[model samples]
Target chain A: MDLIVIIDYGMGNLRSVEKALEKASRQVMVSHNQGDVRAADAIVLPGVGAFGDAMVRLKRLGLDAAIKEEVTAGKPFLGICLGLALLFEESDEHGVHEGLGLLPGRVELLPTNLKIPHIGWNRVSVQKESRLFDGVPNGSFFYFVHSYAVVPKIDSDVLCRTEYGCEFASGVERDNIAAVQFHPEKSSSLGLRMLENFVS
Target chain B: MLSKRIIPCLDVRNGRVVKGIRFLDIRDAGDPVEMASAYDHEGADELVFLDITASHERRQTVVELARRCAEELFIPFTIGGGMRDESDIRKVLKAGADKIAINSAALENPGVIGRCSKRFGAQCIVVAIDAKLVQAEPEKKWEAFVHGGRIATGCDAVQWAIEAAGRGAGEILLTSMDTDGTKQGYDIDLTRAVTTAVNVPVIASGGAGNLDHLVEVVKKANADAVLAASIFHYGTYSIAQAKEHMAAAGIPMRLTK
Candidate 1:
């Protein structure tokens, strides 16, 4: 069985991600231990808090380096919502907070005209063909709840884009690393299919 | 464009769905997990599980139920009722609920919204306001209520919504007590009043009898989402049908195949 270790840094709702992965037919465990992270076939960093707080928690538990090592070694990694933002170079949520720097991007708040949180289901427009969205339809709707979004320096890293007031990168795929601004665990079946594809 | 959402609310009591849902494939209508799965399959944009059984023991039951539902259903679900403080909100969110809705507790201490939103991001905190129209001499105004509409808070509904949003609540669940259970249709005046006052997404609840009622709330009142219980619970119309109706009405909706 492929074990997917969900990084727990005392932030966000990890159980929902674990349950989603379990339902996706993958062996899942939530752990902050570096050893457990290193042993996993895939790693998922799911977060739902301020970028600075999440970074502080990740560093405090020493899981930040573990995640960097695991992802650098070509293990499949997935980030959800705030987790997706953390994969970028930096974020300006509360202040200028440094991120894991796995991808070339910076997280910033959405346009003021759009709802601050952007909380609802929005259609994702697939930008490229990738393993992450193997079976999911091009315009499948996904659940989104965030105020800040990652603006990748390299446009090709964007796998899917969704529109609120302005078009933004909703999902990104760079080699073995995949992340989505939307919460797949809260996005119904098409979301589960995305997780299943990641596990497969 | 952000599509308007249709949420099916399940009132759970004693870990079981209280209102019997009528669906063809559902073997147990009283099971919240089963019913939630059904709603997810039907492409409900979201689900709200309100714990009518607000006892301390039953709160844990609701948590377990939330866990089960989270495992089975993929759509976003909100858990409301019995949420007292930040700890209670944490417990529910940790139990796999995407968001926690606070009603009476919020009225008792409005700062809870700011605290929870600050700690857990505004997206995870929803302020559910139960409002009823007050008969005044010149003009009628909606007043916020508490404890399942048993106690009047005397707070103006519109002002409370604006205050909640300003305090960092991500969304507002506004239910009109007068229109509740009547199925006459949502109080468009009340919904519009709150939606116009708050920048956060407003979920118009109560008095949804037909697809047109849902349409009226979203289009006429500018509700970001429409939440209904008996209409969906009794299977008068499936979520798909409601979405189709909204789509036909030119309200943007995420229609699933």
Candidate 2:
């Protein structure tokens, strides 16, 4: 029995992620305390909000260093939405704000030609094999709601690619680190399947 | 390709699903969580529980509804109705609702759209516009209606939608009062107008009578999503049937089967 800690950085809905993980039949709790992150077998960073605000909160709670430390220790780290974007070195949202620098690249706003938010169920084309999207099909439709997309400097870090106005990294992975721009908890059964894989 | 979403809108009063619902296997049809889970099982892309509860105290029940739905429902769901302030919206979202739709409150003080969107990301804030065609002169003009379409704001619906989006509304839930109960079809002109004008996704609601009507709105009007009440509530058509029909009509849908 593994304890999964869904870091609550005071942003967006976390009950869904907690519920989804609980549905996977695992011990999971939402916490912002660094001790809980240290105690858990695995940590899940799920967020939906602005890049700069998320970073500010993460740093304020002192969970930023705690998160970086855990990820460096090779814990099964899963980032969702803003959690994914925050892994990049920097983001161009609002202004140039530095990120966790956990993964290479910078976050850029989605091309203005298309809808700014890119809100809908879009297809994710898995670029490299990763545990994040284990049973999910190659071109499965996952729910998306965001204005910015992540651009990894290294291609190997890219886990999946989705096309809206252009092909962008929707999911990325390096070692025990994995994150996705889409919300798997709200994306129906296939999404639950992905979360189940994470716990296993 | 992004699949156009098919949402089933449930009008709720006093925390119970209102209106005539006649689903066969559902034990407690009045219970919104059961109804929502049933819809999820039937392949409904997303669910909307519009709280039509008139009283302010009972509004807390909607937050309870969001909590229950969050526990049971695996897919996305939106909670609309009576969210007047930023605190109300935050309460609902914090309760685990994927999105919250603000209607009359947003119309009263359009500034709430910008304030709420800024606090909670735009993705979670949806502005629901109930529009009715009051003028049909040389150029068609639709006015925004409030209080269940009983009152008109004199505000142009199309322009309101544009302003709502500009004010940071992630999605616009446009319901045409003209074709709402008519069951003929969605207001193609009105829906198309808003969908074209807004940079964000426009969910076309109202007039969803039959399977073809569902296809008609998405295909002709280019609605990013379609929300229906009677057509789905009364068991006229299953979500599978509706999605398949729309998909067959050359519309991209979340068709797993």
Candidate 3:
């Protein structure tokens, strides 16, 4: 399949995600329909705003289970920002809300010392090899603006880490599923390169 | 490890990018799409296009410009100015603008922020506050200005910032009309006042003449980002140069790979 489906349930920033994926020379289609996503070569779930709100929308559109199935089929799956956080067990941003449970982790608020909503570009250091970051240079910075993070229960779930007052997972990959806390679309050249790697 | 964001603010008038001194020079810069594409390539973290135009010309030009830039720009870009209603905001967002910033319109309709935040996620909505330090009221509080900084709104700047946050604004873009174009530095008191009052990320705009001014605002005001125009447009400094200075000063920027 030549199409790269960007699952949009009305909560995520879809246009920038589409433009970035297209910049990677991938034919992208932003859709909420599971059937369309199932037909695509790969899938991307880009999110912004509150975790509770995002989960509510995903469930409302019945995309949560669809996404799980898509990843289970062994196609490349990528989550961004809140999309990454929503791949965990639950989040406490506004209240306790269940996540997709695709990975073993819990989304919690970033520590208070380093400022709430870590806004701006942050560097990512690879922790291991993964197709998601294949050609991306080491120590590349990706744009991040979030209030919560995923705390992986198992260390192998972590793919890359970055420090902001405290070190945290910036990128995570397991099998066909990979997610990043930063916005590669908005992260500039290094970010575009990562998108290129993911699509290629 | 957050990198310092270098944002270039484009003041659009009659479908053209323009810059001025205290909003007076009003000279054309170039095509908004071309300029934006250049910034996107030159390492700008994000871009802001303020529709400084006065008529319906904004609709045709801004939309066309946004669509053109979105075709090439891979980073997030915000569009502001002359956005008076939900339809206006919708038009831009549909045209590929990542975020919509409302200033005068938001002040006129207090519910605008809540409405926009609800319709489009809060992260896609930015509330811009243009404040001027009045000499002093009997209450000794600086008042904010609206209507293109032509009229004094008599409201406290900090109070308005808090109200905007309470209304579900995702971020605050505060511009010091008093210090704008002065090239002295940002109004630290004003920047600190609003940022401390609101939990959202505050972009310190206006009066950024040099790299030191940017560092001072980040350090003293606790601002999440800094924005400028003339220095970047005139090529006095590049985004890389400014970030290098900030990095050297121990401001904690994301290092380039």
> Which lDDT tens digits does candidate 3 get at residues B1-257?
66667688988776677753221123323667667766766677889998877656666777776777677787789988777888888888888888889888888897988988888767778998999887664443557788878888878888998998889888899999988989999989889988888888899999999989999999999888888898888878877788788889888665452
In order, the B-chain TM-scores come to 0.97, 0.97, 0.91
The C-alpha stretches of model 2 lying farther than 4 A from their native spots are none
**Residue range A1-200, candidate 2, lDDT tens digits:** 38999999887778888889998755898999999998898989998878999999999999999999988998889999999999989999999999999998999998758767788898999987777677778899888888899999999999998888788899998899999999899888899999999888
Better of 1 and 3 by DockQ: 1
lDDT per residue for candidate 1 within B64-147, as digits (tens), equals 876787677778889987878888888888788888899999989999999998887788889999999997557779899999
Provide per-model DockQ scores: 0.75, 0.75, 0.53
Per-residue lDDT tens digits for candidate 2, residues B63-88, read: 98888889999788999877879988
Scored on chain A only, each candidate's TM-score is: 0.97, 0.97, 0.95
Q: Any residue pairs clashing in model 3, and if so which?
A: A121-B3, B3-B254
What TM-score number comes out for model 2?
0.95
Model 3 stretches with alpha carbons more than 4 Å out: A49-66, A92-97, A111-115, A164-166, B20-29, B136-141, B255-257
Give TM-scores for every candidate, taking all chains together and pairing residue i with residue i. Answer: 0.95, 0.95, 0.87
- What is model 2's C-alpha RMSD? 1.8
